[model samples]
Target: MSLRPRDMPKLRDQTLRHLDDPTSNLRAKTGDENATGLDGLASHLRVGGLYWVAPDMAALAMSSGSQLAAARWATADRPTPCGLIMFDGGIGHFDARGVQIPIEACAWGPYEGECMLWLLMSRRRLVAEMARANLRLDEEQAPPLLPVHGFTVPVTTQPAPLADLDPSVPLPVIAALAASWLLMQQPNLIDRTRERPDKSVRRSYARAGREDPEVTVVDLRRQYVPDTADPDSGRDGRHYRHRWVVSGHWRNQPHGPGQSERRQTWIESYVKGPDGAPLLSTERVNVWRR
Candidate 1:
């Protein structure tokens, strides 16, 4: 869809209406390393800070990955088209040994065939359009758009640690960190550039937890779910469950590439229901390289 600076306000209002609408459903798949669906795809778009329409198709398989490529031209502004907007190959499948290996099989393309219906409105454009919408992407020197908040959950199929929760760091902050790390690791699924908050946001988050204190990182517990169970409401209700070792330590410069000293620890985590119980338990152990 072509959107100009003037049309941003209406777009934003409509986008938010759909996003917040109780009738609008959000669907997602939990596992399947090679799995692709509307939820994850939509999440990627939302995380990029764009408002989009509901996807029309579920998941499908196409034999030829080349012919499968779908492209569309979208204009970011009024005068000229911004760029050639293309579908990044929703998902593809290949038959192997009579088994449909769309996800597990190597050489298979990133999920192909799913289409996203979007009513995107640039955050900057929205602000300019609305006399009182005082938000500026340039003030932050970032993307002029703010991704939707529907898909911020971790993508890993395993649950998070429950017992021995990090006393130093708040659960919410750690969850936020996990979400950030997951997004950073999987740039394809989500871009790190858009998520990077100014130093202030990070400072606010880090100020609460043990800063420059001991650092702990847990081992990764992995789970792969192919047949992701999505909610009936069309929401990507995929659950992530995993265990990891929690470690604590100190380094002269945090995240610094150069040399530094550090400490560590081991802790277990898994998904839990609202009642506060193990959602899924496994023999997986949490350990660090050190």
Candidate 2:
């Protein structure tokens, strides 16, 4: 797979379409990982960012400890390709205790074939491609993170964004900010880029759902307290309930440097009023780091 700029879109489509086929040689995994066939290798890759990479390059990128390594690799004169477009040792799906690192929204590689099929590009390879052609980082805000070999890399994996793989949907600001921070502590977000974006949280949420981008984020809120503070006051009220996709792994975990995971809570404020109960209002997702 010589994945140049022109090759990505078509290659991505084929992989996604055949991702679930267990018998297919290109299928992500072969045995145990595909035993059930329901959550096959491709499915895992999709849950991940669908980035693929080869072993040597994967190791090189991981060793570089930054997603920005692509910037460096592109200008470096290396002996072997930092990565092959697509090649998997003797086995296309070789299982070599592969390295899987969390870099912002994208998952890097299954370096030595630890089963999970990753559609990943080594950070260097990916960035190099992005530089050579027209590729833009719309909502990818998480900073470069050092790579770790196992599933226990300690970076919180955010719920894949609605516009993750889709370039058509306009970027969701606050939502994207909130989601990116879930992966790594973006120092640039607070000091450098805070004032750069003028889009409001209210606008991001409103436009994101109203347009029905990709992944749907539903905001469910309920009034638990009745205004009169009496059960027999005939006030109709309800409790808030809704499921938002959360990080399936690495909750409250730490990664490189001295940075620690901060406690996060989403609080909905309400006060009792003279009326029996207040009607539901508009929904907004605000991102704050203070």
Candidate 3:
């Protein structure tokens, strides 16, 4: 479950209190002494990769499936939570030296930076309650409060040929396909309305899968589940429809008449529906690859 809005201030204060304490020294602790193995596991996990630390209380307090299903944790959830609390506003990486490397994400929250501080504060509170015999949890096995977060985007989108595109492009496409994906986080100028499906929209074609496949016309809007998934879709179940062409060229062929008849492919956009009412538009572009 997400943190309650009413408790945000208290939670932030508790986290800051532990982090500001000079004696806390959460980052300096060794593997055996430190609850988080950030320093010890940095090399193995790769500092640039995403990592997370969560307080014990967060586990029980949050939804079992929904919380973990968040985009950040969906791909990187680990059995054990990391303990190091970073001081920056986002993810971080270390250099050759043990010096801290600060990285920031587009979004910010307590879990982003100073996560350890929050965890520590929660733990201290739990320990205090236990000492007073007020803790309802078992002494030997209290639930773990883990911070939910992770890394994404090793690089941004760049030019690529359909045939030359890395196979991994589909993964990011999958990410984009999800309704909760970050692509829709920003406001876009598109008015989507839902319409009853005329039928199970389907398209198929045969192509010589040589160096590349010929452009295949695909109605992305029809393929998408606007009713349940597409964020742009209106409540009525209708949404704007756009036509896209996944094109490719033969490996041995060039773009001209003199080109060899090889298999090459690329995408062509025939229609767009954002800036103005839906209109015919054509543009040849390669799909994004990871």
Candidate 4:
């Protein structure tokens, strides 16, 4: 059945409860690697940041890897501080073979195939509960919840497509495209690494009679380098280059055996201008925090 607006909260709570239950078999089946990426993305999501996934993107994600594909879509926007995936469409469930099937088609309640699903990383309560249950083992040692939780809300109208996305494209390929774009815009932002908790965290775990867990941390940094002199303004004293920001976009990249396969890659946003030149405009990113 289609989710009711009033049932959103209960659905969220129920999903979280399932995820929190260590023994529950009803877990989101995003692959282990994708789950790690989703968990890391969740931890970085700003408290109140809402990332909207267009209907087409949501469909592509579901077709690709369900929750992880959705996560990849959410991160492609590079929502700063933190963000949650607010997908407006029908809910889906994974089959025994790990393929996504519409929830209504399963042995569940009837759904109109029109709804909004809010998916986010349960970074606090669920994580804490799992940690307590696992006794401070590393993530590899103790696989936490899929780290992604979701709920659905019924919508009266169908969602409109935000962009022309090819349903045939896999989510990972799109993710790689988004990553390429992000790398160009803010190269340092992608520097994610896994390391053991700091001394204080380790000590806290020790006090609790547990060992420290390894955590994935991303280093967020942005740098603006302006040219000292305009290359176009040489000798002739003509201002050939003005300060401008290059828009972010995706391009096809060749790969695979003999580079025979082509994949989508994102081009980063960059500033182009002579050194010390005044910028015609600047890009602003809005970040929401708890």
- The model with the greatest lDDT is 4
lDDT by residue for model 4 (1-290), tens:
43222222223334445444445443344445444333333333312232333344334333333212222223223333233333335334323255432221000111233221222322233345467667553443222223333322222222222233334323333333233223323333333334453566567657867544443222332233322343334567555356765554445456669998554443334555676667775467422111
lDDT of 2 by residue, 2-30 (tens): 33222322333344445445554433334
Q: What is the C-alpha lDDT of each candidate?
A: 0.25, 0.28, 0.26, 0.35
TM-score, predicted candidate 3 vs. hidden true structure: 0.23
Off by over 4 Å in 2: 1-9, 27-29, 36-40, 44-290
Q: Cα lDDT for residue 173, model 1?
A: 24
How much is 27 displaced in model 2, in angstroms? 4.9
Stretches of candidate 4 off by over 4 Å are: 1-189, 197-213, 221-243, 255-260, 273-290
State candidate 2's TM-score. Answer: 0.24
Tens-digit per-residue lDDT, 37-75, candidate 3: 222223222112122212221211121112221223222
**Which structure among the candidates has the greatest TM-score?**
4
Candidate 4: C-alpha RMSD after superposition: 15.9
lDDT of 1 by residue, 1-290 (tens): 44422332233333334334334432112233312333333343332331111111111112111111111111111111111111122122223345322211000011223212221224444355454546443323222333221111222222334223324222232232222222222222221111133455346447756232111111122231221221122245644443222222111122224535221111112222223323344477443221
Candidate 1: misplaced stretches above 4 Å? Answer: 1-119, 130-196, 208-290
Rank by TM-score, highest first. 4, 2, 3, 1
Query: Candidate 4 has what TM-score?
Result: 0.30
